[model samples]
Target chain A: MTRKILRNVGVPILSFVLLLLVWQWVVVGFHVASYIAPRPRQAFLAVTQNWSALWPLILGTIRETVYGFFVGAALGLGLGVIMAKVPVLQRIVYPVLVLSQAVPIIALAAPLVLILGFSVTPKVVIVAWIVFFPVTVNVLDGLTHVDKDLLNLARVYGASRWRTFIHIEIPATATPLFSGLKIGATYAVTGAIIGELAASDGASLALYQEHANANLNTAAVYGTTMVMTAIGITWFLLVVGVEVFATPWQRRTVARRWRRR
Target chain B: MTLLELRDVAKTFGDTIALSPTSLAIAEGSFVAIVGPSGCGKSTMFNVIAGLLTPDGGDVLVKGERVNGTTGHVGYMLQKDLLVPWRTVEDNITMAKRLTGRVSAADREEARAVARQYGLGDFLRHYPTALSGGMRQRVAFMRTLVTHQTLLLLDEPFGALDAQTRLEMQQWLLQVWRDTGRTVLFITHDVDESIFLSDRVIVMSPRPGRVVADFANPLPRPRTVDTLIEPAFIDLKTKVMRLLHREDA
Candidate 1:
């Protein structure tokens, strides 16, 4: 077991280290200027040197992203279930949602910041907006496209509408719902940063990036970008972890299906 | 007592008639099988009886109570096992009671006992995806039986199984039917299966389906695979085949 886990963990780490070494070698060997394309060592140095200043920015961005993720996820799941169960509501609301999706949430961020007074609310709301569509669409697809046989069984067995929704529809849609949540988690970070970019008084990663670029500290800008990527990847992994814990049955089901195939 | 009775049940979709007005009766504890070709409206009849769809004409009576355009009176197993993949065997088995808000400790205990009786005690916590096809059908059967409803409707329940598994399921179904004494209305296209498992076999005509013939299976009780070779079984098979062939011609 230990050896297997080592092989699983070791290969990715080794490959990543090799790529970084190659990147470092290429930058140093070619004498690339830092201002144009920051060297790997310089980017790493920028992060270390700016740690004290960047710490608060990272925390602020993370707070907004986390809040946005939960709010957006909750709204998405609730709306998805409602729209799936109530077709009349779906008919009234679906087209509007589709239209809203076409209008980029980033474009509305500045207006939202202006209206909401540049607080975390705009960022969180923007993040929620960004995430809400995919989550809702995935959930809708999963619920609507369920195995017809299962629905027939529910009908024949006297399952009430609510009962059917809880037992049949909800469980069936869980994997897809989690898939939406994972996508939403990654977008939450981007949404928060964009909102911060629109207007922010306090420290945020977006503010740092803007300041870094203004000072022509390209390495610092790269460092800020790296931090944001880290945050997004971390949040995504958290969502995946929760999904694994929540639906252990899905793994078993998939494995069983493969075995049969 | 007549557990279920259909009177002049006729259904149409748009301009296409699925079933012609027809009447049938099932006693309180007898096993009846319906045999027909593809598109003969055997499924339509089951849907009407199970209350998934209401017939355009006539009434569906369950225990003499007119139940039309409604569902959930009888236990129904579809052409496939239709077990919810996410739910455990025990949970699936107890779902009928759960849906009606009638599930209790006793009901759950009974479900467990029934699972054990059906040789699924070891798999009570296992999901449908983990079970073999035959095991999954057994789970479906336990689920249907646990409803404790006197009337059961099985729509080609073993039609998806291999020949060997299908034979075993037929024997298992017979034992279960005999033990429970529940009224069963089963649908199938297999003449041998219909004769082996049913007390009476009702054959329907094509398209705007109507009952062409109803034969009381003359095979003796406590039948087994050996019974398949019996002269009486062959004679009944020939008779049913002749009717089905005549309709095809």
Candidate 2:
């Protein structure tokens, strides 16, 4: 078990340390100006020194991201199921959905804030807008493309529409649903930051980063960026953990395939 | 007792005739095998009886009730095990019950009992991916059996197995059929398999498929692999082969 944990956790940490060393070497050797690009240690120190001041802003951004992600995920799943059930709705809505993704979320963020006011609501709306497309598209694909044999099996046994949906459709679509959720998780962080940058009355990570940039506090800016990245990574891992819990059978299948190799 | 009757049932897809006006009567608790070449409308016939496809003409009667274009009258298995990869063996077995209505504790107990009775007790919690091909097929069979339907339509259930496993599965299937006393209509192109497992062998002609000949097996019950070489089995096989070839000519 310890060996397994080392393989999973140790390798990544070792690689991260190597990366930090490289960053340090590049900064010191080039005699880079600290104001232009802070050393990794400087960035780390900046965040730790101002941890008390920055903690609330980080928490606020996280809260907005969580709210937006859940809202978007729920809306995407519900819409995908609806579209799958009714092909006519899919025909009308799918093109619009794709086209909507073409319009940049950044373009909509300012107006969304202007209309919704400088509250968490606008930020959540922006995150939700960014997160919904992948979730809906993936879920719809999963639902529409369920194995025909399984569907026939359900029908042969006289499963009702609702029962079939519960038993066959849901299980079949779960993997794809998780795929969308993972993508949405990363996008959700970006959405929160965009919304915060557009308008936020309270302090947020984006606002903090903007202030640090204006003051030429490069170390603080780098520190804030690192925090944002950490949040994105944490959300992604959380989704992956949920996926593993939900789909135990998939893990076994994957293990079997690996053993075969 | 006639459990299922198909009278002058015909089907067409666009301009192509898939099945002719074919008629068949399946007795209660009889094991019947249908052998035919590819595209011989065996699947179309199975679909019609399973109520997945409505016959263009005539009627399909189950227990004296005309059931056409309606489903849920019989248990059906396919060449592929079609076991849901995500479900455990026990869950897969009880899937039919879960689908049709609520699965009570009694239903789960019965499923466990069936699995245990069939030597699958150890695999109740195991997913389909963990099972061997033969075991997966057994699970598929158990799933169909748990549906509690009197008639089962198995379309080449062992077609995907290796030769050795297929032989073992054939015997296993025969034992299960005898133990359950359920009427089984098995579809396969393997003439030897049709003679070995079934009480009756049905030979079907090429597309626009019609029953060329229906021969009752003279072999006794609890037949073994050695029965494949029995004179009666050979004679019946030869006759079925002749009819199939005659249709080709």
Candidate 3:
């Protein structure tokens, strides 16, 4: 099992290393303009050299995204379970939830900025809004997909509602909940970036964008984009790790797929 | 004294009446068989008696106490072995006891003991998907036993098995019934199985079912598969077929 986990982890890490090699060798070989594609070493140094400048902004984005992701996900999960179980509430409330999303998040971001004003609140709101729908839908599917035969078995056994939910519904729906969390994690990363971009004119990655544009530092612009990509990858891997721990069953399923191949 | 008695028990589904005022009395420790054509309320009669359904109007008495609205007090084995796929074989057998939170260490030990006796000792930790159909049926039967209910309700428990497995299970069931001596009300469409397993057999009409005839199996105790060829066994089946309006060789 340990070997299997290591092997799984190894593929992505190796891919990343090969990517960096291509990036470094390509820049060196092509003598690519620094503004267009800085050497891999320059991008690597960017994080450590500018730690004092970058840490605060990075932390600030993380804080907003994490906060919004959880708040929205928690609300979505609770509401989704209720909606799945109660048809009348579902009928009354579902369209509102659906309609809320059809209008794009960016379309609403401007008004949000106008009202909330260049604060952490706008970013958090973006994260929350983005994360909410996937969490709700996945959770609802998970909760509803509990087996009918199991329900009947429980009924025949005269299991109490609390016991039934704890034993049957929760375990039965574990995979779906993890799925919701993964979506929420992806949304959270996007939400943070959007929040940072929309909120302040001269701070964080967006600030780097401004400086890079004014100086015509195309490599710096690409470098900032590279940083963003790294953050996204880090956050996604974190979610996947948590999912593996939370649902070993999923890991077993993945292992089976690997075997089949 | 009757262990279970159904008085004028009827069931209706919307416009269709399934059973019409069917009454039955099963004595303590007796094995009673109910056989009828497809679509007959034979299964419904047992369902009503098992407390899975309420008669449109009537009373179900178990040990002289009314038990129609009571579910879980009677253990029922359905045609399909409804074992939870995620649960292990041992867990499947004691599922009801675990669910009700009454399955204690002693109860589980008893469940394991029963499984071991039934040739599933090796596969207790195995999942349902790993087991064969015959093995699944045995686990289902073990589940009914673990419920520890005095009245057992089985609806075609061996109906899904192949011929060989069916015969094997029928023998296993007979031994289990003989040893446990739990009052059993088994419903089936198979005529031979009805005669082979029952102390008394009740024959029913197709729809709006009623007990058209009852016969003491008259076969000797410790009956086996070979008993099907006995003169008395053939005699009993021939009589039931005549009542069923079917020609017999």
Top-scoring candidate (DockQ): 2
Q: How many residue pairs clash in all the candidates, one count each? A: 0, 0, 2
Query: Over the stretch B26-89, how does candidate 3's per-residue lDDT look in tens digits?
Result: 8989999988786678877776776667888889998888888667668788778987665667
Q: How much lDDT does candidate 3 score?
A: 0.79
Chain B TM-score (model 1 vs. true structure)? 0.97
TM (chain A) per model: 0.89, 0.93, 0.86
**DockQ, ranked from best to worst:** 2, 1, 3
1 or 2, greater by DockQ: 2
Report how far residue A46 has shifted in candidate 2, in Å: 1.1
B86 in model 1: Cα distance from truth in Å?
A: 1.5
Best by TM-score: 2
Candidate 1 stretches greater than 4 Å from native: A1-15, A253-261
Off by over 4 Å in 3: A1-7, A10-34, A37-42, A111-122, A200-261, B234-249
Q: What is the interface RMSD of each candidate, in Å?
A: 4.8, 4.9, 5.9
Ranking by lDDT: 2, 1, 3
Q: Please provide, for model 1 over A136-239, each residue's C-alpha lDDT reduced to its tens digit, 9 standing for 90 to 100.
A: 99998899998987887888887888888878888889989999999898888899888898868876789889998999999999888889988998999899
List native contact recovery per candidate, as a fraction of 1.
Answer: 0.64, 0.77, 0.28
Model 1, B83-118: lDDT tens digits are 777667777788888777867888889888998987
Q: What global local distance difference test value does model 2 have? A: 0.90
lDDT of 3 at A199: 76
For model 3 the local lDDT of residue B112 reads 83
Q: Each predicted complex: what DockQ?
A: 0.52, 0.56, 0.32
